[model samples]
Target: MDRIISLFSSSALLLFILVVQNTSSVYGNAEGDALYALKKQLKDPNNVLQSWDPTLVNPCTWYHVTCNNYNSVTRVELGNAGLSGQLVSQLGQLSNLQYLEMYGNNITGIIPNAIGNLTNLVSLDLYLNRLHGRIPTALGNLQKLRYLRLNNNILTGTIPFSLTTITTLQVLDVSSNRLRGYVPRNGSFAFFTPRSFANNPNLEFPPDAPVAPAPAPLSS
Candidate 1:
């Protein structure tokens, strides 16, 4: 009778442990699935994304993907990997993502508004791509954004005034795009120079703004 009771207790403990493990696995798999969705849309000719296996419980082990202590994705470093194709909206599902580095690729298509959901984002580097369409005003939601580099794309339309509200912005390079309209010269824009809007022939500086003289030559 004693032996039977001990066996039953052991079995119950084992079942409890399995249940906990499975619950955590399910949460991790959701993020993994979101990344896998992006993989399907991209053309990875060099097999850079070969390690992105959906069967894995978490994407932390995947190449070019970084995760925190709790296994939540924090950074995705896949710049210049020769990837092309449209970005999927599911990328916004990475709730904990902080750094999204996908610059210097042949990626085309408009910037997805879903990206605005990444409120924790610190840097959004999509420069040197073939992306077009107006800059989404929804990006104003990223209060923590410090570096927003969307230059060298085929983007059009006026720069969203809402972008000037991000006080934490330290570096903004929207140069070389097809952006139009008057550049905001107030708030965070006050710190930027004409060079930030250079090469965008349609964009104009404030009409009454004073012209800055060329810097004096440095003493030899």
Candidate 2:
């Protein structure tokens, strides 16, 4: 009787472990799927993303991907890897993502509004790219964002006033873009300087600004 009872207890424990592992696997697969979608969109000449195998149960084991103790993706460090191509909206699925550093590449296309879904994001660096189109107001949703750099791109349209509401923002750089309209010098923007808006001739300061500089003449 003791032998039968011990076998039953062990079986139950094994079943419980399998169930827990399967649940975590499913969750990890969702993140992996999101990443694989991006992999399909990119032109990785250097095969930097070659290790992103879909058959893997967890993305944490993949290169350039990082995860927390719970196996949820937290960072994707693929900066300056000679990658060119566009970013897909599926990137927003990384719920635990904090740092998205994909700068100094030839990535072109509009910044996906879906990126605003990463409320936990702390840094978003897309500098030195060929991305164009209006900056999405949805970015205002990132309440925790600290560093927001969109410089050296061919982006057009006015800077979104919604960016002024992020109280936690520390480093704001929109320089060297084709942006237009007045710079927001209030709210969290009070900490920034004109250097942040340099090279954007169309971006001006309001006359009421304490040290209002004359708006530059637009270059033909």
Leading candidate by lDDT? 2
**Deviation in angstroms for 59 in model 2?**
1.2
Which candidate tops TM-score? 1
Please give, for residues 1-220, the per-residue lDDT of candidate 2 as tens digits: 9999999999999999999999998989999999999999899999999999999997999999999999999999999989899998988999999999999999999999999999999999999999999999999999999999999999899988899999999999999999998988888998888888889878888888766467899999
Count the clashes in each prediction. 0, 0
Quote each prediction's TM-score. Answer: 0.88, 0.88
lDDT of 2 at 30: 90
129-173 per-residue lDDT for model 1 (tens digits): 999999999899888999999999999999998899999999999
Q: What is the Å distance of residue 19 in model 2 from its true position?
A: 4.7
Clashing pairs for model 1 are none
Worst 10 residues of 2 by lDDT: 205-214
TM-score of structure candidate 2: 0.88
Off by over 4 Å in 2: 1-19, 212-220
Q: State model 2's lDDT.
A: 0.93
* RMSD to the hidden true structure, all candidates: 3.2, 5.1
Q: Any runs in candidate 1 off by more than 4 Å, and if so which?
A: 1-23, 210-212
